[model samples]
Target chain A: NAGVTQTPKFRILKIGQSMTLQCAQDMNHNYMYWYRQDPGMGLKLIYYSVGAGITDKGEVPNGYNVSRSTTEDFPLRLELAAPSQTSVYFCASSLLVLPDSTEQFFGPGTRLTVL
Target chain B: TQLLEQSPQFLSIQEGENLTVYCNSSSVFSSLQWYRQEPGEGPVLLVTVVTGGEVKKLKRLTFQFGDARKDSSLHITAAQPGDTGLYLCAGKDTNAGKSTFGDGTTLTVKP
Candidate 1:
């Protein structure tokens, strides 16, 4: 099913630059999430969507925005990049929020570095 | 936000030894998941324990959820080089639609 896929495996951005990280899932999951992993730290959620038109902020949503216009695509936007925004980003999808449905499939990851 | 803490932040062991990684939290969860991540790669789900005191096995790996659903542990038997990676635990709160993650346990199994 190709599960979940993310674009731009590696990227470097200058301070104040902007870009969008793309994520897609063919699994037709109802839930999609964006998370960032700083070096030597646990992952922190940036944003998430429960459905195609429903989006919400997560643990760490600063410097980031998201849009879920379709069931398969959830994109994260960086308005003005900062060194603090440098981290590995992951996209994941799941069927629902039920305990049995908590198994999330993750994309390879997108590594971003801001200078 | 709920927090999860993992123990033995780093470990280096011989290929044939056994190891256990722990995830603990002060809050209860509906379910807990274990994942393995290799360098430059996102985590892959290894197992998910939903019920309190539930136990599951995969190959040489055994996963156990705490009776109160506030903790979990992953044990690997006769570890191998292929087992070297960062192991992570995530706790899910269905009602909140959010999953909190532990920092992770980095394991190095030398051949």
Candidate 2:
């Protein structure tokens, strides 16, 4: 099913440059998320969507934005990229949280290096 | 926000040895999931425990959920080099699609 797929597996951005990280899932999951992982740190949530028209902020949502135009896609937008934003980003999809889904399917991850 | 903490942040073991990784938290949960990730790749689900005090076995690996659903453990009966990877535990939170993930345990198995 190709599960979840992310675009631009790697990217290098300059100070103040902006870009969008693309994430899509073919499993028709109702929940999708964006997370970032720094060296020696656990993955922190940046943004998430419950459906095509509903979205919410997560633990670390600063310097980033997200849009859920369709149930199959959730893209993260980085505005005025900073060195602090340089980290490995992952996209994940799950059926639903709470009483339904406990397992999450993750994407290949996008490695970003701000120079 | 709820938080999950993992112990033995790093472990190095020889082949055929036994090893255990722990995930703990103070907040009660309905379910817990374990995932393993290799370098340059995303995490893959290993197992999920829903009912409290539930125990599940997969090949040489065993997973247990705490009776209170506040903790979980993964035990490897016979470690192999293929088991070398980062292990993470996550719990479903009340915040809809959000979840709390523990700091992963990185294991290195020497064969």
DockQ of each: 0.79, 0.70
TM-scores, all candidates, are: 0.97, 0.96
| Number of the top-ranking candidate, with lDDT as the measure | 1
State the lDDT at B94 in candidate 1. Answer: 53
- lDDT, candidate 1, B1-111, per-residue tens: 789999989999999999999999999998999999998888888998999999999999999999999999999999999999999999997587778999999999999
- Angstrom error of the Cα, residue A64, model 1: value is 0.5
lDDT of 2 at A96: 74
Candidate 2 chain A has its poorest 10 consecutive residues by lDDT at A95-104
Q: Give the range where candidate 1 chain B is weakest over 10 consecutive residues by summed lDDT.
A: B92-101
The per-prediction CA RMSD against the true structure, in angstroms, equals 1.0, 1.3
The DockQ of predicted model 1 stands at 0.79
- Tell me model 2's lDDT, rounded to 2 decimals: 0.91
Top candidate, metric DockQ: 1
Q: What is the lDDT of residue B35 in candidate 1?
A: 91
